[model samples]
Target chain A: MIELHRVSKVYSVGPVKVPALREVSFRIGKGEFVVLTGASGAGKTTLLRLLYRDDLPSEGDVEVLGYGLVQMRRSQVAAFRRSIGVVFQDAKLLPVRTVYENVAFVLRVLGTPRRDITARAFDALRAVGLSARAQAYPAQLSQGEAQRAALARAIVRRPPLLLADEPTGNLDEAMAGEIVDVLKDIGAGGTTIVLATHQARLAVALRRRTLTLEGGRIVKDEG
Target chain B: MLGFLVGEALRDLRRAGRVAVSAVVLITLSLAALGGFWLVSSNLGHAVAKWRDRVRIVVYLKREPPGGDVAALLERVRVMPGVAGVVFIGKADALRALKQVLGKDAGVVDQLPVNPLPASLEVTPSAAAVTPEGARELLARLAVLPEADDVAGSADWVERFSHWQRLLTTIGLGVGFVLAAASILTVTTATTLILHARRHETEIMRLVGASEWTIRLPVLLQGMMQGLAGAILALGALVVTHSVVAPRLEPLVSLTLGLSQLVFFTPVGVVALLGAGTLLGGLGGWLARAAREP
Candidate 1:
């Protein structure tokens, strides 16, 4: 679950003020698949970032999974992060680690038991249809395959919340459709999914509860 | 859990082997610097101990006691403190020894036909009077004696040698400081590189819900490993250096300098050196992690 009440985020670059979110108010319910749509500089990324406690809101309050984002300590951030899966626009897999290790990286970071990390990592790889290529490096995989690996890493912990920032930005149209379909399957399996994007065609196809943003303010919230 | 920590550490080391190597190099340089200081101080101590075996003081004899009453004069020299096994070396013996050293140079021997060398009493000082300054002060007391010409042994040469040794020690300290500073800088730079290369990996780990402790343990272990490896290398270098140099200096000044008695690291000493290396490496890693804003 995600909630924001009159939240605003502003950035100051040498006294030149830039606002990313202007008193935004929204709520994303548990098990709901939501698509956040906006053009560049529309504050979509800032909203998603607030969910994981990455970027704190400048005004008002934001809460995710019942924890106040602004109030959470650094130690608490780790626990919060462990409860959600995130897919950044870049995939951001460790270049030195193999695909399996990258997925296992999160589990290991959480201090998961060795036996469980290996078993779970294998299962997650299989879920992404990457079982055969688990040992491959990120550089060795196709763009779609790497994205799928990233997807496996996100869901490996089985967090109730999943956020993807422009997950299909670098993929072909067909690949984007497939990625969306995969996310739909995850949402069906009871994971709350919040996907952010700029492409109207990709957004239209998801056919989920949608929130549209223009400039720094939300213009529409439609189911 | 220990294995898991070690595994994580090894993975980080393997991933960033070059950075790890650089850190180790820094650790080793520091170890070597401190080790060198210990080696010099200990070697000097050993040499001084050996010199103590031949510790002696020279007391010039009175003018043969005009009455030829040699008994009282020699007796007085014997009663003085630290007169261990005093032996009288008359002018005749002194002349013979001097001739042997200078080689029978005719003109020089003719010029000293009257035998300018004085009859002297060689007194072995107590171990308490082993320091050059100690010997000099005692000799000065002996010289003012109305009966004697001048005290000779354990004089200027000892003081000069000690001064040179102290100068060397000061230089050694300066060198050690430079080496330590260089090492700290090197370790800091290397750690920065390690952090940089893994920045993305760190971001990924954050995404996956890994705890900070889990992510940090490996980096700590890697730093500790680098330090240990560097220390071990330095130890090997010292051992090899001692082994090679000890033999060459044996016959040259073994008696006076006692180079053979120059002992290298004992087990405890080696451990101390290794521990120092580990601490520096571990601390460097800790600083790097602590300074990270992420």
Candidate 2:
């Protein structure tokens, strides 16, 4: 579950106060696949960051998985992050690790048993169609493969909620379609997904609830 | 998890390469400097104890007195508060001892027209009176004796040597402090380098819900390992140096200080040196963790 009421984010650069999100409010039920569409600088990433408690809203409340982000203690925030998977535009895989290790890293952080970790990581990679590339390194992967590896890493822990920020921003149309299909398969497995993207066509093709943002405010919500 | 933490730490050290090596070298230098001074101080203390046990004061008389007068003076010297024992060495006996000391040059001493050495009472001081202050007080009393013209004792040299030892210890402490600081900073620099190199890895770890300690423990272990390696190396260096130099210096040490041989660190000393190295490294890790990210 996710909830935000009248949330606003402001970034102060020098003497200027630049608003990234303005009193944006939204709710998504469990196991929903939701697309967040916005132009560049339209608060999609900011909203996702707020949901994960990466950055707290300047004003208003953000509730994710039953914890209030605005007032959560740092320890609580860390605990809260474990229940959710987040993907940045950059795949952010450790260059030194193989894809299997990268995905296993999430389970390892959770102190999962070594045997369980192998099983879970392989399963996650299989879901993303990356089990064959498990031995490959991040540097050796194509843009699509890297994104898939990042996806496998996120879902390996089987988080209740998944927030992806432009998971296909750098991919070709064909590769992007494949990533969307993989995401759809993940959502079908009942993990709530909130995917942010600047591509309206991707949002339309997914046939999910789409929330469009412009100048820091949500302007449309339709399926 | 313990295995993972330790493995990660070793891997980090390997990744650290030159910076880690620098840290180890710095630690070795610090511990070696400290250990070297410890050895010096220990040997000096042995010398001091040997000399203190043999402390003697000589009251040189103007001339040998008559039989009754000599008996009275010897009795008076024996009754002094700090006099452990007294032996009267007459002029003829002093000359004989001088000839024995001169060894191959005994003929030169005999060529003199008459014996020039004075008759003296060799006063062996009590344990308490062997100290510089106590010896000085005893000398003052002996100097006032009617039969005595001069009172000579080894107290001044003992006092000066003790002072020199203190000075050396103080200097050693000051140098050890500076070197220790440099070693800690070197470890900090190396840990910081590892932190920077693995910043991305750290962020990923945090995202995957790693505890703060889980992320930090490896870095701390790496620092400690560097320190430990350095201490072992320093101990090895000290052993080699002592072996190579102790034999050459044994004669001089024996001749001057009455010590048969110079020795390396004791078992306790070795443990302390190693422990200090480990502590310095841990301190560096703590400092690195405490510093804010720029």
Candidate 3:
């Protein structure tokens, strides 16, 4: 579940104030798949960042998965983040780690028991169809495979909410379609998903609830 | 979790490469300098203790005590506050001692026109009176004796040797502190480099919900490892230097300081040095984390 009420974000770049979002209000219910579509510099990334508590809203409230983003302590941020999954545009996998290690890294960090980590990590990898490439390093993977590995890492702990920011930004149509299908499959399993992408056609093709942004304002919200 | 941290620390150290090595070398140089000075000071302390037990004040008499009066004089000086005992050395006995000291040159002492040696009472001071101040006080008391001509105590030279020992300690500490500061800085720089090298990995870790301690501890451990390695190497160098150099210096030490052997650091001292290195390294790493984040 995600809720943002009258959220406004202004970034300061040396005496100049750049407003990235203005009075945005939205409520996303449980188990909903919402696509966030916008042009470059239209604040899609900023909005997702707020949802995950990476950046606090400048002048409003952001409540994601029961955490009040503006009021959460810095120490509590990590725990809150662990309760949700986030996939960036770039896969951002550790270059030296194998795909399996990358996915298992999250479980290891959370201090999951050794016996449970293997099964859980492999399950997540299988869910993203990256089980066959588990042994490959990030450098060895294709762009699409890297993104799939990132998805596996995100969902490894089976968080209730998943946020993807441009998960298919660099892929071709067929590869992008493959990633979108995987996300759809994940959504079908009852995980609340908020995905940000610049591709409008992709948003229309998915036929999910979509929030369209133009120049830091949500211009349209429709299914 | 501990094993994972140690593994990450070692990996970071390897990633730091030459900067890490330089930090270790700097710590080694600093610790070695400190240990070397400590060795010298410890030996000097032993020599000071040895000689303090043997300190004697000699009161040269204006004239030889009349035969029957010698006993009275000895008894009188014996009861003085710090006088442990008194030995009366007559002129003839003094001449004989001089000839004994002359060894093969005994004929030179016999060639003198008259017995040039003065009769004296050798006063052995108690342990409490062996210090420079105590000896000076005792000498002052004896100088006022009616039969005393010249009074001298061995405390002055012993005090000089003690001064030299303290100076060595102070100098050693000064040098060690400067080198230690440099080593800590070098460790900080090395850790900073590793942090930059692993920035992407760290960001990913943070995003994945790794706690600040989890993200920062490896860097701290890396610094400590560097420090620990340097300390071990420094101790090794010290041991080799001591074994190879102690025997060659013992004869001179025995002649000058009256010590039969040079003493290296005690076990406690060794641990202190190692602990200092580790602490310095840890501090550097902690500072790096503070600077990087804050």
List the TM-score for candidate 1's chain B.
Answer: 0.71
lDDT by residue (tens digit), candidate 3, B1-294: 777778889989999999999999999999999889988888988988898878899999999989999999999899998889999999999999999999999999878999989999999998878877889889999999999999987588888888999999999999999999999999999999999988987887788788888898899999999999989999999999999999999999889888889988889998998998898889888888889994
Q: Which ranges of candidate 2 are over 4 A from the true structure? A: B57-130, B138-154, B292-294
Candidate 3 at residue B232, lDDT?
90
DockQ of every candidate structure: 0.47, 0.46, 0.61
Q: What is the interface RMSD of each candidate, in Å?
A: 1.9, 1.3, 1.2
Write down the lDDT of every candidate, Cα atoms only. 0.79, 0.89, 0.92
How do the candidates score on chain B by TM-score? Answer: 0.71, 0.79, 0.84
- On DockQ, the candidate that comes out on top is 3
TM per candidate comes to 0.78, 0.84, 0.90
lDDT of 2 by residue, A1-223 (tens): 8998999999999999999999999899999999999898898998988888778899999899998888898877668888999888889999989999999877776678877988999999999999999999999999999999999999988899999999999999999999999999999999999999999889998899999999999999898
Query: Can you tell me the CAPRI class of model 3?
Result: medium
Cα misplacement distance, residue B217 of candidate 2 (Å): 2.3
Give the per-residue lDDT digits (tens) of candidate 1, residues B1-294.
567677867766776667677767766776777687778767776665556767777777755444365666667666766555567778878888887788857357657648877787787766656567667666776787777777778735654665666777777778766765666555656666777777786777666656777678767776777778888988888888889986776676567685655678889999988887777767777777888855
Top TM-score model = 3
